[model samples]
Target chain A: MPTTPAPGTVAPAVHLLAGALRRALLEEGGGFRLARVLPGREDSCAGLAAVRVLGADALAPFVVKGLALPAQDAALIRAAVRAHPAPQEPERQVLLWGIRDAALVRGLAVSGVDATGWEGLAPAGSTAHLLRLPWVAMAAELVRVAGAAPPFAEEAVHAQLARSHLDISRGLVRALLRRDLPSAACLTRWLAPAGEQLTTPALDYLEIAGADDPRVSLDTAIARRLTTGTSP
Target chain B: MTRANTPISPQGDHDDAADRSRNVETETDAAAARLAHQVGERALAWLECMRGSFALTAETPDDHVEGQALKSLAELALAAGMVRREAIAGPQCADTAGRLLDFGWRQVGRGDLLYRLQARTPAATYPMEIYAPFAAAGYRHERMDRLAAHLLGLRASRVIEHVPNRRLAVVAAAATIGVTVPDDVAAMIGQTWLGGTPEPWMLDAGNAYGVTHTVFHLTDWGGRPEGLPQRLQDYLHQWLPVWAEVFCETRLWDLLLEMLIVGTCLQRPLFFPAVWERVAAAQRADGMMPNGLTTPPADPHAAWRNHHHPTIVAVVAGTLTLSRAISHATTAGGEA
Candidate 1:
């Protein structure tokens, strides 16, 4: 079992990754600028070096050497870290932080890795969904940025980015990222598409019909779908 | 419409800070109680207002009469201790003011009331006009209308307490239609109703008329279950369908479904299990469900999506309701 950090200690490894990623973006322009400025053009130079040191990958050694977790656990953490590389773009970096933050806070361990050293990352369609996650402080900062910036238009890319971080089945975030609709209506449309493709129908139904909305038809549709497989 | 021109601190008060604290505490308590009472009383008054046979007629009170009548009545009512000034200034009073303003505009447009008393009334006027009879009843019609309008503007600040974005839209639609929702529901709308002309949708004759009818159903007609279920059902069946057809997308459809499930748990318990079963049955192995039965997928995410949060909440709520119902049924069977 992975050793857990004390409450007051540095946030568990996953959080460290998210926090470090966030700090890299807000304070240090993330690794992109450092990569650009570095002489060797090596992946581990400059800002990328700092991320490698402090992010999810760095936690394995600390857990193995400092916390005394098994060597195999550290190896697993190293492997997962290698698989999900640090995000390059500032927006993608923030999104990674949000997903990891949500996962850690929820106590969900990433599979095939040290749960304590987990990094949360998920695909999200818009800055709005990224901000809507439960990480209050980070989400708030992101919200502030979103409010100041122009509305995001690249829904497909954002959706892909969100999926990479979380365990949400495909297309869930994409459905949420579509043009604004009343909350209830949006959920209804997501759960039960009028289209013929039915992959992952249960999850879609769950996603769309779980929240509130002002539009009554959306609710009715969900209720109808839930009760009769027909929109009410 | 009167702005506070003079600042008067209560006399014999302590230092400014102490006085301010005491004033704030007293004002806050008073405001709370006053709002509570105003909301309750105005709701009652609205019921009464709609009870009698209301007909749209072609009579317009003279503008001067309307003005003087309101001023004299305010003074008499205020002086004679018949009505408190705060009664006209309270939150409920503001809600009334808003409704009446909408009502007045509708009446004018319908040619039931003249636009200007001095001008020729519309050529084809409806009979049985409903003018501001309160002016004749010793209340200031114009001032009362003004006070209502002003109060409505002030009360709009409450809208800010609601939730944001889509949630806000839901609460706003409810408020626009004069549906008194619980505080939690109101909080969903998340913005103050700053003083401005009400939205066109809010004031639209059709919506306004619909509100009047809904209010009547809620109050006088004693519509089933206080007309809440019926009102909600009507909104789902009629108003919201149109809105969905017009502006809603697949994601919005998902959000709406969640709201309905939540709403069913909150408002209509009987329908909970049926709704849940239908949803559960429709779920595919990968956990995606269709949006509406017949409509084309509104978006790509309409397929291959799994949202755990809403599912968990719905499952929990549905399980509880089902357990209780089953227990009830078993007990009844034993007794039989």
Candidate 2:
């Protein structure tokens, strides 16, 4: 489990990534200069470039580690990606990189693995139906990045549950990274049955939706209580 | 018309920060009562002005008044009639409403003339505008039903020709009284070809008039059960604040009223009360609200005629929003 930092504590990874990003972009001065802080980190230049493409807001959750972004911000990133054209390799790496591991980004880029339904899937279609597709097919690239085998072989799962359940998978990625048990549990219960065919350990996390878990975030707490594998 | 303006706070006498501390039930009830009172007062004052004599001369070759000007009077009648029925503006307004509605109906050949008169309007000009409120007010005249059917046909013709946005007024009128639009018209209105284009006339996400009419039609004039699709709802949620700000700055009361309807449809009374405050502030002592801050014709009668449209719209907007807000607040309070 990633250590949950106190509020306002900037993670070292965030600072490092941000520092590398600053060095890459020679913008008009606004804040701290990255080149001055961390002189040489050429290895993560591609990651920095990717971060710039995907934007710091999208990559913030991974960089900050345990911090769960507000659902609205998470939604904005998805919307922004859908609105724009598909990015190239390094940029795709930065954008698709959900975890804190550099190796995962490399593996995702080289694997050239087609997320099951992504190829012919038009991003500009009805968002509701797009969200309804099987989670594995929808997040196939992320699954490969996370080293989880794809969920299905033939049939696709339609997300019959609320639209917010579609968002849970993204939230689950952050929770899995954080290893926040309560949060993961709540997300799993809500997402698992909806995308029943999905094959990931995160699916079996814990069904504690609505549990009075002060340790976890408010969203996760509410989600846990709302779904316990009993209620729809 | 105007681009950008500083944000105008909606915090009339109600401080939102303090509102947070107070119980939800109490706040909602208080807000409802206050709004209802404000709207009721304004509606009465507006009724007093509209109660005078209305012109009924047909806008043919001889009449000085353009058919467009007279058509607008009927639209005002429909709005005033709506307030009269709401029991907000006193019962005396009912006779005035009937007079205006009947006069407007008569001017448009009382649904008897088959000749497609282009009278001042760009496309076909019919009594589609007045038919909506007429039907809504429980007037069972066959002419209204006929006009509604004519509108549906016009909508069908508009769709088949790939015309955009022009059919909005007819479609809006139809929805005002719960007429189910044909599948073709629905398809035409639903999909936008210029999704990515910056063009202002794109029906889905451009031009204030098209957007407002689309919203009005889809939401069934703020009477739809759930209101617009999630995507459109999201779009309105983002741009309405900006649109409201601009319209309010330009002093475009009619468009601003439409914005209030959109706000009501989205169930965000909190975001819109500021507009109501602005409208209420703009009202003159004798109940005349100018169409905009734009200068009116120097002739007193011309100014009166010009001022009447916004005043009628303002009254309707206030009555509709306030009544809806009270209902919403009441429901919310009960739930709390």
**lDDT values of the candidates?**
0.31, 0.45
Docking outcome class, model 1: incorrect
Q: Local error of candidate 1 at B34, Å?
A: 0.8
Where does model 1 exceed 4 Å of error?
A: A1-110, A117-232, B1-33, B36-126, B129-209, B216-336
Q: On a 0 to 1 TM-score scale, where does candidate 2 land against the true structure?
A: 0.49
Please list the residue runs of candidate 2 whose C-alpha ends up more than 4 Å from where it truly belongs after superposition: A1-232, B1-44, B47-65, B88-125, B140-165, B172-181, B192-206, B267-271, B295-300
Report residue B23 deviation for candidate 2 (angstroms): 4.1
Task: Judge candidate 2 at residue B305 and give its lDDT.
Answer: 68
- Give the number of the best model, judged by TM-score: 2
Q: Mind giving the per-residue lDDT tens digits that candidate 2 earns over B94-148?
A: 5666655665455546543222332233244344555566566665456456555
- DockQ score for candidate 2: 0.02
Residue A127 of model 2 has an lDDT of 21
Looking at model 1, residue B93 earns an lDDT score of 40
